[model samples]
Every structure is written in C-alpha cells, then in structure tokens.
Target: MANGVMIFMALYPLRYLKTKVDRLGKADLVYLLTTSVISIAVTAAVVVTLQNGITTYLLAGVASLAVWMSTAWWVGRSRTDAPGTRER
Candidate 1:
C-alpha cells in the first residue's frame, strides 16, 4: 500500500509537470501536491481496510504498474498533441 502510494506520488509529479509546464504557477503546484497527498491517503486507507495478503499484494503490484504505464501514455499523448508542443 505504501509502495503503491509512493509509485503514484512519483508518477503524478511527472504528469503534473508535463501538463502544467507552460502555465507553471503556484496554484498548479498546490493542486498537484494536494492531489498527490490525497491519492496516497486514499490508497493507504483502502489497503488498511482490505488487509491485502501476498496474492493480493502481487495483483496490486501488477495493477499499479498498469496504471502507471497508462498514465504515462496519456500524458505523452497529451503533450504531443498540445498546440506548439514538440514531440521529443
């Protein structure tokens, strides 16, 4: 659960930074931080409530990786599609 939250925290920054680079304001930073913290808290709560075991843990790991990859792809697509944004 903690690991999942950490993964989300790390990936979220990348997406937030990419999406908000041009705007790059304090409000954006605050929003990103708030969302990240909330996501972590929610993930921890769910994990605690469910009390996941080894098999569930492995499944969670796979799900986390899938989410991370999908988010990365979405971010990449949005970045590339933005007006005046170059694909790198």
Candidate 2:
C-alpha cells in the first residue's frame, strides 16, 4: 500500500489536481484525475516511441505534459462555466 501511494505521489500532474480540488468539487475532480492518468499513459507511450536519447525522451514527456494539462484544464473549466452554474 505504501509503495502504491508513493508511486502515485511521483506524478506531478496530481499536484496540480491537488491545488484545484476545492474549486473543482467532486465531479470535476473525478474527470481531472481520470484525465491525468490518461495523460501519463500517453506521455509514456510517446517517450518510449522516441527512444532517441534521454534528452529527446525527456523533451517528449515535458511537451506532452504541457499539452495534456492545458487541454484538461480548459475542458474542465468550460464544463463548469455555464451561465447558471458556478464552481463551488
């Protein structure tokens, strides 16, 4: 159990999710977390495909992370941004 938590803690995207927990509320939290996991998996695939060198793979990871995080945040915000609805 301890090992599993430490592995999850290593994911920096979860840190961003952590900061947004209060404002995002329960529903969006689930969305963001699921998105975060998908982002991690996709990033790993891209990094593995590169396989050129450490520098290239690292860049792939960073670039993909930026794209995924941005898209997730934007989608999450739009979903919660209806005229009659407000983040809680």
Candidate 3:
C-alpha cells in the first residue's frame, strides 16, 4: 500500500492533467503541474519524517485519495453545458 501510494503520488498529476485538459489554459496547467510536484515532494518528506509505520501510510493514502476524488468531482462540475445536465 505504501508503494502504491508512492506510485499514485507520482502519477496523480497525469490524471489531473487529462481530466482538466479542456478547461485549464497552458499557464494554469503549468502552474498546477509545478504545484503538484512540490506537493509530492513535501508529502514524501513528511511521510519519511513520520516513520510511524502502516497507520501513517494508510492515513496518507486515504487522505490523498480523498483529495484527488473530491478535486476531480469539483473540477468536473465547475463548467457545464447546462445546469440540468447529469454527469455521465
């Protein structure tokens, strides 16, 4: 699970970039990409410092996954063709 979270931390931005490709401008995307890199680095450092074993790993994984899912949903809803339209 820790390895999986590390992989996710690395690849998460690709998922974000693909999802927001149509909405974000190049500058905005670049900025977001930079931030994501910084965030991953910070998370890695924090995880190393915690050294608390599985509990910390599990919590970090869950927290990161939750943030990703919520952000995806939020960005997906921020722009729409119609208010009555349902998400596919």
Off by over 4 Å in 1: 1-11, 14-27, 54-88
lDDT values, one for every candidate: 0.52, 0.57, 0.54
Candidate 3 Cα outliers beyond 4 Å, as residue runs: 1-4, 12-50, 81-88
TM-score of each: 0.41, 0.52, 0.47
The digit string of per-residue lDDT tens for model 2 on 23-80 reads 4332255566666666666666766777677675567557656755665656655675
What's the ranking of the predictions by lDDT, best on top? Answer: 2, 3, 1
Pairs in clash, predicted candidate 2: none
User: Which residue pairs show backbone clashes in model 1?
Assistant: none
Candidate 2: RMSD to truth? 6.0
Best by lDDT: 2
Q: Which run of 10 residues does model 2 get worst, by summed lDDT?
A: 1-10
Global fold similarity of model 3 (TM-score):
0.47
Please write out the lDDT profile of model 3 over residues 1-88, one tens digit for every residue.
Answer: 6676666666656665544453332223444455455555555665777779877776666655555445544444454532344557
